[model samples]
Target: MFQFLKRDPVKKLRKAYDAKLEEAMHAQRNGDIRGYAMLTSEAEALWQQIEQLEKK
Candidate 1:
């Protein structure tokens, strides 16, 4: 079975979510509150997607 070779969407999305959080952290550190909020929102969206996928 080649199921093991298939790419996992959840895993991919989680990686993106982590990246977004890191970016948001950097933005906050740089005093860009707007950028940080935007990035954090995007990361939250990604987390929602991951949750939906896991529910399937």
Candidate 2:
């Protein structure tokens, strides 16, 4: 009965993933290779989670 009240985890993860990618872009532009790599890895992990959730 409260389904509407529940937030979708995948959506939240996707938002985080987008933010991470944006940050990664900025890092790359600023020549922060290390930060860019870390953010890209985190975004990739979030994408995996989103894919897994979508499969279900």
List per-prediction Cα lDDT, in the order shown.
0.99, 0.97
In model 1, state the lDDT of residue 51. 99
Q: Write the per-residue lDDT of candidate 2 for residues 1-56, one digit (tens) a residue.
A: 99999999999998999999999999999999999999999999999999999999
- Give residue 37's lDDT in candidate 2 (0 to 100): 99
Considering every candidate listed, which one attains the maximal lDDT? Answer: 1
Candidate 1 CA-lDDT value: 0.99
Give the least accurate 10-residue stretch of model 1, judged by summed lDDT.
Answer: 1-10
The residue-by-residue lDDT of candidate 1 on 1-56, one tens digit each, is 99999999999999999999999999999999999999999999999999999999
TM-score of 1: 0.96
The most accurate candidate by TM-score is 1
lDDT of 1 at 23: 100
In model 2, which runs have C-alpha deviations exceeding 4 angstroms? none
